[model samples]
Target chain A: EAGVAQSPRYKIIEKRQSVAFWCNPISGHATLYWYQQILGQGPKLLIQFQNNGVVDDSQLPKDRFSAERLKGVDSTLKIQPAKLEDSAVYLCASSGEGSGNTIYFGEGSWLTVV
Target chain B: SQKIEQNSEALNIQEGKTATLTCNYTNYSPAYLQWYRQDPGRGPVFLLLIRENEKEKRKERLKVTFDTTLKQSLFHITASQPADSATYLCALGLDRGSTLGRLYFGRGTQLTVWP
Candidate 1:
């Protein structure tokens, strides 16, 4: 079975520019999540979606960050007016229905903001 | 605020020896803890999950122990190999009922196995 897929494995952008990353979760997975991992740090949850509806996005920066899971299978995360501090690996993950279940993650999209 | 911590030091062990990594957390109660392995330039892969009600869980050569009172979990890989050299991450599932499945992760520990 194929794992989660992400687009543009690496991206470079200027401080004021905008960037976007895409993710395709595993087949039949209902829970999708977006996380940002700074260098030398663990991943921080940015948003989560269950199907076409958002489950949690308390950590997302509304001013610059936005994400949508259209059709409940593919997702896109966007950061407008990116800052240098936004340089990090954007990771996407998916899971089934339970909290104790295993979650599958994509290779991640690495962003470097200048 | 809830916090998760893992050993920042790189664990070096012989290829045939067992490798043990530690994860500890403070504040907030978690219903389950999970372990994941990550290679450089890659995302984490799920390794194991242990619930608070369960004291131990094993998957082949991998074993996990959870101590809720101490707020700690230990991951052990027996007969370790060089291929097992990677960053190990621990995560806690924040429960708010209905299994929303939000996880808080720890800074992973790097492991190296010597031949």
Candidate 2:
């Protein structure tokens, strides 16, 4: 079985610019998540989607960050007016329905904002 | 407000020895906990899961013990190997109205095995 997939394994952007990351979860998975991993820290969940409906997004920076999972298969995370502090790895994860939190993560998209 | 913590520093161990890591949480009464292995520059991979009622769970060479009373979880690897070197993370499944499980992860503890 294929694992979670992410695009642009690496991304470089300038402060004040815009950047977006994409994720393709495993087949038949209904729960999708986006996490931000800053250096020297664990991945922090930014948003979660359950079949195209957002279940949680309490940690996301609504002022600058947004995410969408249209149709609930793939997801996209976007950051506008990126700041230098935004530099980090963006990881996408997925799990099946009622799986009890056994999430599978993607390789992640490394973002460096200069 | 829940907080999860793992060792912030890396653990260096000799090959063929056993490696053990600890995770502690505060202000959370999780129903289940999970462990994941993450390599540098990669996403974390699922390792094992242990519920509140389960004291221990094991895979080939990996074992996890969860103690809810202590609010701690321990991850152990037997017969350590160089390939086993990676960061290990502990996650707590938050109860949010029976919604799909949402996890809160710790910073992770890096383990390095030397031959």
Candidate 3:
């Protein structure tokens, strides 16, 4: 079976510019997630979607970051007015319905903000 | 505040030897824990999961032990190979009386196996 798919494997933008990342999860997966991984750090959960509805986004930066999963199959994460700290890898992952379900991740979209 | 911590330093081991990694957490009682393997510039791949009720789980040459009393998880890779060189992350799953819960991850332990 195919794993999670992500687009624009790498991206570069200037500070204060805007950037977006797209993700297509595995077939039949019910849960999708977006995570940000800074260099030398673990992936931090940014948002989670369960079939077109948000499950959790408490850690999301409301002022600068937003994400949506309209159809429950695909998702997009956007960051506006990017800052130098926003330079990190955006990872998209998908899982089944249970907490014990294994999460599969994409190669991730690398962003470099100047 | 809840915190999950793994050794930030890299671990170096010779091939054919056993490699051990530790994950420690504070201020949280997780229902389950998971281990993931990550390569440079790539996302993490799920390796194993152990429940709080279970003390140990194994897959192939990998073994994971969860100690709730100590709030720690130990990951062991047996007969390690050079190919096993990568970062290993430990995540804790918080159960909110539902099938889904949030996962808090550690900074990960980098393991380097040399031939």
Candidate 4:
């Protein structure tokens, strides 16, 4: 089976600019997630969507970051007025309907804000 | 808040040897734990999961042991190879009356196996 798919494997943006990353999860997956991985750190969840409805977004920076899963199959994460600290890898992952199921991740979109 | 920690120092082992990584968590009781392998510039790939009731789980040459008393998990890779070199992450799943619980991940342990 095909794994999660992501776009723009790499992205470079200037501070104050805006950037977006796209993701297509595995077929039939019911849960989608966006995580930000800074250097030398684990993936920090930015948001989670369960069938287009948000499950959790407590860690997300609402002032600068936004994400949406329109049909519950694909998702987009956007960051406006990007800062140098925003430089990191944006990883998209998906899982089946149960808590025990393993989550599969995409290659991730690398973002470098200069 | 829950806090997870893995070894910050990189582990170096010779090929064919066994490599063990440790993960510890505090301030939370997780129902399950998961392990993942991540390579440079790539997202993490699922490796294994061990439930709270399960003391140990194995898949091929990989073994995971969870100890609730200590609130720690240990991941072991046997017959290690150079290809096994990567960052290994441990995630704690805390249930909240949902089929899928939220995951809190550790910083990860980097393992380097040399031939």
True contacts kept of each: 0.78, 0.75, 0.72, 0.62
Tell me the DockQ of each model, to 2 decimals. Answer: 0.78, 0.72, 0.76, 0.73
Positional deviation of residue B69's Cα in model 2 after best superposition, in angstroms: 1.2
lDDT string for model 2 (B20-108, tens) is 99999999988888899999878998889898889999999999999988999999999999999999988888664555456888988
lDDT of candidates 1 onward, in order: 0.92, 0.90, 0.92, 0.91
Model with the higher DockQ, candidate 2 or 4: 4
TM-score of 3: 0.96
Tens digit of lDDT per residue, candidate 1, span A8-78?
89999989999999999988888999999999988989999989899899999999999999899999999
After TM-score superposition, the amount by which residue A2's alpha carbon in candidate 1 deviates from its true location, in angstroms, is: 1.4
* Model 3 stretches astray by more than 4 angstroms: A97-100, B96-98
Tens digit per residue, CA lDDT, model 4, B85-114? 999999988874555646888889999999
Q: Write the per-residue lDDT of candidate 2 for residues A6-76, one digit (tens) a residue.
A: 99899999999999999999999998999999998888889999989998999999999999999889999
Q: Please give the ranking of all candidate structures by DockQ, highest first, separated by commas.
A: 1, 3, 4, 2
Docking class of 4: medium
List the candidate numbers ranked by TM-score, top first. Answer: 3, 1, 4, 2
The lowest-lDDT stretch of 10 consecutive residues in candidate 2 chain B is B94-103
Model 4 residue pairs with clashes: none
Over the stretch B1-115, how does candidate 1's per-residue lDDT look in tens digits? 7788897658999999999999999996989999999999999999998988999999999999999999999999999999999999999987846644778999999999999
Please give the distance, in angstroms, between residue B17's alpha carbon in candidate 3 and its true position after superposition. 0.6
